[model samples]
Target: MSHLLIPALFFLVILVGAFIQPAAARKPYASIPVKNLFSYIEILPPGSRVLLAWDYDPATQGEMQLLAQPILRHLQRKRVQIVNVSLRPFGPNVAADAQTMKQWPMSAQAAAPTEFGFIPGESAALRALTHSPVIASNQPRTSARTSGLRPTDTLAAFDLVIEFSASFANSQEWVEQVASRTQKPFIVAASGAVAPLLRPYQQTHQIRVLLSGYPDALAYESLLQHNGPAHRQRTAQTLALGLLLILVLIAATRSLLRR
Candidate 1:
């Protein structure tokens, strides 16, 4: 009873504070990370090759899609060559969507995005990308695997592989299977829930850039102020946090006065 009551009262206090304070604004989820990503892209040289590793599905698109699209846009803006691969079956197609594509500042030099259609088997498939890539993006120049990729194509000639996944087959797979074997840089953008596990990878440098949640995204948005969804989300988040603080203070004061 105490556990429920005290927390509930605090929530009520927070609600009241939100009504009174100007900080309760709601921002989009993508704003924070987008800004951080923007800065990262700004540092990269033009014409860099980036591999978009889509590893989630339609259900989680809302949280991840916006996050992924803006990064792709920023990379494309810089004329980055993108090679899209998916350990998840739906990842490759999601990577191909233009809504995700439009954000990039694509240039004449940008290679038409490459889709290495879903890797039929993750463990073995990921391992294959390390030494040489056997993957083929279903471009018309090639259709069937025979017309397409060889074992030599596994991890050839790419700069960085950005992994966007929402599954147990996580950054670890990219690390143990691909990055470890090939020594290629692996960047990961995963949901908050998976952050604890990913942190060790980042600390040890198994993954290069790791973004955990809305907080990181918001921080990035705050940094760039790019006037994109990330910025808008920051505004909303600022407002919401302000309100929450106010409510906490009010509740504490009320309790003290009563005592």
Candidate 2:
């Protein structure tokens, strides 16, 4: 038997599986962070400003879509001022959301939460945003003729900056760039793969809230007595991980037996 064929088959299988749009993306579950976001908005006065950061790229979007969508919806519903920012190099896009990024609208019920746009790196951009007079000085996602909104406008006006990270910066970067510079409140939502690394920051108050993927999202949903996409995606995600572990174990066992 050819040993290479086994791993080759795995890739082939995953590619085919990708086309199927696994059960998770269709129905995602809400985690604790979602609920916490819901509650935070509940207590805040109407028309408050919030800076939303998408820290990861396409690789992590599927797992966190459940968290992102509802978070956007809740903010829109609460009439909160939203300033969308992305740290990921290719993480910004607009497709006619409930609230268009075209113009900031606070009272549109059917309105989707508005997006600001992508800045640059975490350190330089965040620092500039905290102090600069104009935001979106360098628009990575939009073209020159499209929208000319400055991220600086949103950053200066917003009260909070929530970083949805993937341990890309260890939470220290946000504290340094946004928190320390402007002394504004910032929160972090990290993937389970990197949540442990962020624990110290949460413990020390370097970051305000910590929302780990899947399970944490579910907890938040429970807190609000609301259920959403994160739950379903997490279920499928859970199943997928379980299958991968089993496959890994079997392969290890077979290799040991052969040895």
Return the top candidate by lDDT. Answer: 1
* Model 1 regions lying over 4 Å from their true place: 1-40, 98-111, 134-156, 222-224, 235-259
- lDDT of candidate model 1 versus the reference: 0.63
* Per-residue lDDT of 66 in model 2: 45
Whole-model alpha-carbon lDDT for candidate 2: 0.59
Model 2 vs. true fold: TM: 0.63
Error of 2 at 151 (Å): 8.9
lDDT (Cα, tens digit) per residue for candidate 1, span 187-213: 788876666777788788777677866
lDDT of 2 at 113: 39
In order, the Cα lDDT scores of the candidates are 0.63, 0.59
Report lDDT (Cα) of residue 72, candidate 2. 59
